[model samples]
Target chain A: MNALWKVARFTATDIFRSKWLPVYTVFFFLIAEGLFRFSGDSGQALVSLTNITILLIPAASIIYGALYFYGAREFIELLLAQPVGRKPLFTGLFSGIAGALGGGFLIGTGLPCLLHGTADDRITILAILSIGVMLTLIFVALALLVAVRSDEKVRGVGICLGLWLAFAILYDGLIWLVLALFADYPLERAAIVMTTLNPIDLGRVGIMLRLDIAALMGYTGAVFEQFFGSRVGFTLTSGAMLAWIVAPFMLALRSFSRKDF
Target chain B: MPPHDMGRHCSSLEMMSAAAGQILRLLLLFSICFACMRTSAVHAAEVRVGNGVDFAAAVAKAAAGDRIIVPNGVHTAIDVKIDKPLEITGQAGATLDGKGKSQILIISAGNVVIRGLTFIRSGMSYVSDNAAIKATGISDLKIENCSFRDNFFGIYLAKSSNCIVRNCSFKASGRLESSSGNGIHQWYCRNSVIENNTIAGHRDGIYLEFSRNAIIRGNKSLNNIRYGLHFMFSDSCAYRDNLFQENGAGVAVMYSKFITMTGNIFRQNWGPAAYGLLLKEIADSHIERNRIEGNTTGLYADGCNRNTIHFNTFHRNGWGVKIYANSSQNNFKDNNFLSNTFAVSTNSSSLQTNVFDANYWSEYTGYDLNRDGFGDAAHHPVRLFTILIERQPTSLILLRSLFIDLLDAAERALPVLTPQTLADAHPRMKPKQ
Candidate 1:
C-alpha cells in the first residue's frame, strides 16, 4: 500500500506539472469567468457552465488519459522491471491521471462559481462540478481500457475519441430515435431507464433536476423527478455513476495485468 | 233571611257583583297576555344561535328572510342543509368545527348569505370531496368575511349561477397532492364573481371547470400543491390584478376561450414541470400587461391558437415563451423578453404561421441604423442549439458553450438551420422602459 501510494503520488506530480493540465485548468477558468461576468444572471451562468463542463470534460479526459498512458509507457515498463506488482502499477497510474484531471476541473470551475455565485447558486454549482469530476473519472478509465487493449497508440487514440463522440453526441441521437419510434407507447419509465444507460444523460438530467428546468421536459421530466428527486433515487443514481467509474477501470486493470510487456 | 234574609240578599248581590268584577278582570288579563305572545311571535325576525342551541337545528328552524346570528364560540360539527333564503352570520371568533367527519356548511337554497365565520377540519373523502362550504344548485348566494382552515375543499360551488365569493381566506394542510382539493373550486356555474380572496396550500388555489363568465380579480394565491388558478373549458372569463406566487405549476388555462388575462403578477413558480402560465389547447384569448418573473418557464403554450399576447414582461425565467409546433395564428407583439435562458423555443423547424413582431429581445444585437427605435435587420429568436436541446434534452448540457454559441451565431447570420419565417421583423433596439 505504501509503495502504491508512492507510485501514485509520483505519477500525479508528473501529470500535475505538465503543460496540458495547466492549459485545461486555464480553459475552464476563462470560460467560468466569461460566463460569470457576461451572463447577467447567476442561474444562466451556472447553466452555461454546466453545459461546458459536460461536453468538454469528458473529451479532455479521454484525450489526456490516452496520451498520458502512451507517453509514460517507458516509465511503466521500467517500474514493471522493478519488483512492483502489475495491480499496484495500474491502480497507481489510474488514480494519478483521474486525480489530476478531477482536481483541475474542481479548481478551475469550482473556485469561480464559489466566488461569484450567490447562496442559492451554490448547491447547483456543486452538483455540476461533482458530476464533471465523475465524468472525468469515468472517461479516463475508459480511455485507459482502450489504451491497454491496443498496442498501437494511434489506434488507441482513435478508439478513445470515437468512444467520447459516441457517449457525448451519438448516444442521444439513438435515444431520440428510440423515443420517436415508440412514441405511441407509455415510454416514460423505459425512457428513464434508457437515460441511466448513458452516464452523460444521467448527469445532465441530475443537474437539470437540481436546476429546476426538468419541468420543460414534460412527462419524462416528471418521471425523472419522481425517481431522481427522492433521497433513494439520488443515492441510486449516484451509486450508478460510481459504478460507471469503477467497472471500466476494473476491467482495464484486469486486462493490463494479464498483458505481456 | 227575614232580617237576615234582607242582609243575605244584600250580601249575595254584593258577592255576585264582586265575582263578576273578578271574572272580568281575569279575562282582560288573559286576553292581554295572549295578544303580547302573538305580537312577540310575529316580530321574531332574528334568531340567536348559541347557549346550548345546535347550529344545524337553528338553521333548520329558521324561516325565509330570517337572520341567524352565531355567538363567539366553537360550534360542533354542522352538516346543515339550508333550504330557505336566510342570512347566517357569525360574531367575532366564532368557529364551525367540522370534526374531520363531514362538510361544515351545505347551502341548497337560493338567496342565502353567509358571513363572518371560520371553518375548520372538514373531512377528507375522495368520494364526497368534503368541503368547508359547499353551495350546490343555487343562485344569488353571497359568502363573505370567512376563513377556512385544514379543509379538503375550501368553497365548492357546483351547478350554481350568479354567486359571489369575496374577502375569504382558505388554507389547507395537504401533505400530498392526491389528498388535497382546490381552494375555491367551481364547476358548471355561470356569471359568478370571485374577488378579494387569499388562498394557500390547497391543490389549486382557485379552480374553475366548465364555469363561464366569471370575473376573478384581486386574489392572492400562493404556495399551493398544484396550480394557483386552473381554468378548464371555461369561456369568456376575465382575470385581472391577481397575484399567483410559488404555486407548484403556476396558473394553467386549458381548453378555454375568450379569456382576458391582464395585469396579473406571476412570480417564483420554480419547478421542473412549472410555468408562470400554461395554456394548453386554448384559443381566442388576450393576455396583456402581465408581469411574469422567476419561473422555470414564463409562458408555455401547447396547441394554443389565435391568442394575442402583448405588453407582458417575461424576466429571469428558463424559457420566456415555449410555443409548441401545433400552436399557430398567435400574435406576439410589444412584449419585453428580458434575460431568459431561451427567449422563444418551438419544436418545429417549418415556417411558423404565428407572428412575432415588434418585440423587445434583450439578446438582439442588430444595430438600429435608421434610428427608428427598430432594428434595420431582423432578429431570429430560435437558436440552432435550442432546436438541438429540444430534440434531445440531454444535449442541454452543451448549453452556452462557445461552439454552440458560434453555431447559433452562424445560424443567425445565414438562416440555414433555423426556421426561416420565425424572425421578428421589427425588433426593438432597446427594451421597453
Candidate 2:
C-alpha cells in the first residue's frame, strides 16, 4: 500500500506538470462556458450539456488517457526497478492518473455547475461530473492495457484510436449493414450485444436519461428506458461497469507482473 | 332318432344365418366407400403454378382448403387478400415485388401461413398503413422467413392475435421523419411472437403499443430514425435477447406494467434524449442481466415504482443510473456501478422508499479491514453536489471548488434535505451476484 501510494504521488505530481492535461481542461472549460452562455433557453442548455458530456468529454478523455499511458511507460519502468511490487506501482499509477482526470474534469465542467447553475440543472450537472470521472477511469484502464500489451507506443496508440473509431463510428455502421442484409432475422438482439462492448456510449446513456430527455427522442429513447430507465436494469448495468473496472485492471496487472521491466 | 333329426335341422339353420350376415356386411362397406370417394373428388381443386399465379383469378376460383403456391420469380403489385384458411407458400424462394406503389398482400382471415417470400418496394401512403404484407384482425396466422425492403411498414399487425412472425427482415431507405414508418409495428395485438427479426432504417425498429403477452426476442434494432423498441401501455410482455443501438433513442418503456426485459443490450444511442433505456410510469417490472453501455443516458427512471433492477452493467455511458422525481419504492441490488459518472441520482426531497444496497461501485473508497468482504460503514454515495447538479446543470463548473467540495463533505456528514430513504443500508465492498 505504501509503495502504491508513493507511485501514485509520483505520477500525480508528474501529471500535474503535463501541458496536455491543462490544455484539455482549459479547452473543456471554455467550451462548457460558451455552451452555457450561448444556449439561450433552459431546454437547449440541457441538450448542450448532454452533447458536451457524452460527445466532447469522452472524446477528449480517450485521447489524453491513451497518450498518457504510452507517454509515461519509460518513467514507469524506472519506478518498477526501485524494489516496488508491480501491483502497487500499477495501482498507484492508475489512481494518480484517475485522480488527475477527476480533478481536471471537475475544473473543466463542475466549476460551471457550482457557480452559475440553477436548482433545476443540479442533478444533471452532478451526473455529468460523475459520468466524466468514471469514463476517464475506464479510458485510462483501456489505454494502460494498450500501452502494456504493445512494445511500441505508436502501435499502442494506433490500436487505442482504432478501437475508439470502431466503437464511435464503424460498429454502428456494421450493425446497420447486418440489419440491411438480413431482413428476415432478429438483428436487434445482436445490435444490443455489440453496443455494450464500447464504454463511451454506455456512459452517455447512463447519465442523460437520468435528466429525462426521453420525451423528445421518443421510441429510440424508449429502448434505453426499458433497459436502464428503471432501478432494475440500472443495478445490472452498474454491475457490468464494475466488471469492466476489475477486468481491465486485472489484465493490466497480469501483463505488468510478468513483463521484464 | 327324433333328437338326431332336430339337431341336424338346427345346424343347417345356423349355416344359413352366417351366410346372410356376411352379405349384409359387404353391402354396407361398399356404400361407405362410395361416399368417401365423392368427398375427395369435391375437394381436389388445388392449382400449383411454378412461374407465377394470377392471384386475383386464383383467389376467385380457389376453395377454402386449396393452396396457390407461387414458384420462384418476381411477382408485381399483387394485393391478394385472404378470406379463408389457406397455405400460400412461395416455392424456391419467390420474390413479390410491389413496384414501389402499394401493399403486396393483406390478410383478413384466420388460419393462414405465408412463408419463404421476399417483398420489395412497397407503395407509399400517407393516410393508410402500407406494408409489403399486413395482417389485421387475423388469428392463428404465421409469416416466416420473409423480407420487406423500401416499405412504409414491413409487417404491420393491428387488432390481430395469435400471430407468429419469425425470421423476418424489414429495411426501409425512405427515411423521412414525416412519413418513414416502423419496421415491425403492432397495436392491440396479443399472443404474438416477433422473434429472430432484423428491423432497421425506419422510424421504429419495433413498436408495440397496447399490445400484451407478446414475446419479442432475438431481434436487432439499429440505425432507425426513432427507437429501437418502443412500448407504451404494453403489459404482460417479455423482451429478451434484443439489441438496441445507435437509433435516435435506444429503448423507451412508458406507462407499461409487468414487463420483463432481460438479456438485452442498449448502447451507442446518442443525442440529448438518447438513453440505454427510458422508464416513465413503468411499474412492477423486472430488468435483469441486460447490458447498457455507450449511450448518452443510461437507465433514466422517472416516476417508476416497485421495480427490481439487478445484475446489469452500466459502463462508458454519459450518465450511469438515475432515479428521477416522484419515483419511489424501487429496489436496486446486486448490481455493479463501474466507473459511471454518477452511480445514482434522485430528485426526491424526502422518503422515496428506494433501496440502493449491495452495489459495487468502482469509485467506492471505503475499506473492509475485517475481511468480512463488506464495507465497514455505509457509503454515503449520493453527494449533495449531485443533488445540486441535478437541479442546476450549469453549477457543475463549481465542482471541486473549495465551496462545492466543502458543501458535499458537509452533506455527507449531515444527511438532510436529500432523500433519506434513498440509500444503501448495507453497501457491499464487493459486487453481489
Candidate 3:
C-alpha cells in the first residue's frame, strides 16, 4: 500500500509539472466560462459545456494516456526492477492518471458551473462531472490496455486511435444504418444495448439521461420515455457506466501484471 | 399524442396574465360590465326560482325574453328542456346539481341567454356527448360568466349560429381520454365567439368540428387529456391571446383552412407524440406573434401548405419546427428559435419549398460581416445529427457526443448530408422582437 501510494504520488507530480495537465485544466475553464458568457444563460451554457465535455474528455484522456504510457516505457521498466510488486505499480500508475484527469475535469467544469450556474444547473453540472470522470477512467484504461498489449509504439498508438474511431464514430454510424434499414421494427431496446457497448456512447448517455430528458421524453417509443421516466432504468444505465469504468481497467490491470518485462 | 411543451406551459399561461395586457383586460372588463347592466335593465319580467322550486316549471311559465333568475343555492335542476326563448340568469352562488343523470339543460330555442350559473355532474354516456347545457339548432345564444365542474361537456353547441360564450370556466374529473368530453364542444356551428374562458381536465378544452368563422380569444386551456384547442375542419376562424398548457396530446389544428392565430401562447404541451401546435392537412393559415415554448415539438407540420408562420418565438422546445416531406410553400420568418434541442428537423430528405428565412437561431455561430443584421453564413437549421435522430429514434441516446458534433460541423463545412432547402438564407443576427 505504501509503495502504491509512493508511486502514485511520484507519477502525479511528474504529470502535473509537465504543463499539459494545467493546460488541460485551463482549456476547460476557458470553455465553460466562455460558453457561460457567450450564451449569457447558465442552463444553455451547461448544455453546451456538456456537449464539449462528452466529446473532448474521452479523446483527450485516451490520447494522453496512450502517449504517456508509451513515452514512460523505459521508466516503467526501471520501476519493475525495484522492490515494488507489478500489481502495485500498475494500480498506482492507473490511479495517478485517473485521479489527475478526473480532478482536472471536476475542478475545470465544477468551478465555472459554481460561478455561473443556477441551483439546477449546479446539479446537472455535478452529473456532467461524474460522467466526465468515469469517461476519463474508461478511455485511459482502454489506452493503457492497448499500450501494454502491444510492444511497438506506433502499433499501440495506431490501435488506440482505431479503437477511438470505432467507439466514437463508426459505432453510431452502424446503429444509424441498422435503424434506417429496419425502420419498421421496434429497435429501441436494441439501440440502447448497442450504445452500452461503447464507453464513450455510454458516457454520453449517462450525461444526456440528466440533460436531454425533456427531449428524450419526446421520443415516440415508450422505451425511451420509460428509460427517462423510471428509476429502474436510471439505476441500470448508471450500473452500465460503472461496469464500463471497471471492465476496461480490470482487463488492463490483468495485462499489466502478466506482461513479462 | 402527448404534447411536447407540457414541461412549463401551465406556468407560461399563469405567467401570461401578469406579463401581457393587464390594463387592456381591466378596461375591457369595465366596458363589458357597463354594457351588461344596460342590456339587463331594459329586458322583460323577472321570475325568481331556486332551492327546491321546480326550475323547469318556472322556465315553462316564463314568457319569451323573460329573465328566470335562479337564486343562490344548490338547486336540483336536471333534464330541464326549454323550447322557449328566455334569459336564464343565476344569482351569486347559484349552483345546479345534475344528480349524476342525463343532460342538465337542453335549449332548443333561438335567442336564449344562460348566464352566471354553476353546473355540476352531467352523466357520462358512451353514445352521446352529454353536457351541462346542450343547445341544438339555435341562433343568437349567449352564455356568459358560467362555470361547469365535473361535467362531461361544459357547453355543447350543435347546428347553432351567432353564439357568444364569454368569461366561462370548465373543469372535468375524468382521467381517461376515452371517457372524457370537451369544454366548449361546438359542432356545425358558425359565427361564434368563444372568449376569455378557462378549461382544464377534459378531453379537449375547446373543440370545434365543422365550425366556421369562429373566434376563440383569450382562453386558458390546460391539462386536458387530449387537446387544448382542437379545430377540426373549422375554416376562416381566428384564435388570439389564448394560452394552451400541459395538455395530454397537445393542441391540434387539423383539416382547417384560412385560420389566423396571433398573440397566443402554446406552452409545455409535452408527451411522446406531443406538440405545442400541430398542423395536419391545414392550409392557408397565418400564425404570428405567438409563443411556443417547452414542448416536445413546438410546431409540427404534416401535410400543411401555404401557411405563414411569422414573428413567433419558439424557446426551449424539443424541436422548434418539425416538417414532413409532404408540407409545402410554408414560410417561417422573423421568428426566434432559442435553446431548442433541435431548431428544425424534417423527414424531408429531398428539399421541398418550405422557406425558413430571417429567423434568429441561438445555435447559429456565424459572423455578420456585411452588418445587414443578418449572418453572412446561411444557417441550415437541420443538422446531420438531427437527420440521424429523425431516422433512428434510438440514436437519441448519443446526443451531445463528440462524434455527433463533428458530424454537424462537417455537414456545415461541406453541406453534403443535410437537406439543402431547410437553410435560413437571411438568418437574423439578433432575435426578432
Give the residue spans of candidate 3 off by over 4 A: A1-10, A40-44, A70-89, A118-123, A150-154, A180-185, A218-221, B1-46, B50-52, B61-72, B84-93, B110-112, B347-351, B384-418
After superposing candidate 2, which stretches have Cα over 4 Å from the reference? A1-261, B1-52, B59-61, B395-407, B414-417
Pick the TM-score winner. 3
Which scores better on TM-score, 2 or 3?
Answer: 3
DockQ for each model: 0.09, 0.03, 0.46
Model 2 chain B weakest 10-residue run by lDDT: B394-403
What lDDT tens digits, residue by residue, belong to model 1 across residues B1-433?
A: 1344554557787766766777677666775888633232233488888766778878877877788898888887567788878888999998999999989888898888899999998888888888888999999899999999999999999999999999999988797888988899999999999999999999999999999999999999999999999999999999999999999888899999999999999988877778899999999999999999878788999999999999999987777899998999999999988767788888888879989999988777788887999999988898887787676564454434344565677787777667878889999876666
Task: Give the clash count for each candidate.
Answer: 4, 117, 22
In the range A154-236, model 3's lDDT, one tens digit per residue, is: 99888888887888788877877777788889888888778767777776776665566557767553466576347887777
| RMSD after CA superposition, every candidate | 11.7, 18.8, 11.6
Q: Model 2, B1-433: lDDT tens per residue?
A: 2345655667777656755666566656765778533232234456665334565566656776566677777777467677876777777767888887778788888777788878887778887788887888878889888888788888889899989999988888766766888888899999999899988898889989999999999999988888899989999999999988898877899999999999999978877677789999999999998888767678999889999998887765656777886787788877766545456677766766777877766556677878887777776556786686565343332222234445666777787766666666566675555
Docking class of 3: acceptable
Can you give the TM-score per candidate against the true fold?
A: 0.73, 0.58, 0.86
Question: Which whole-number lDDT from 0 to 100 does residue A261 have in model 1?
Answer: 86
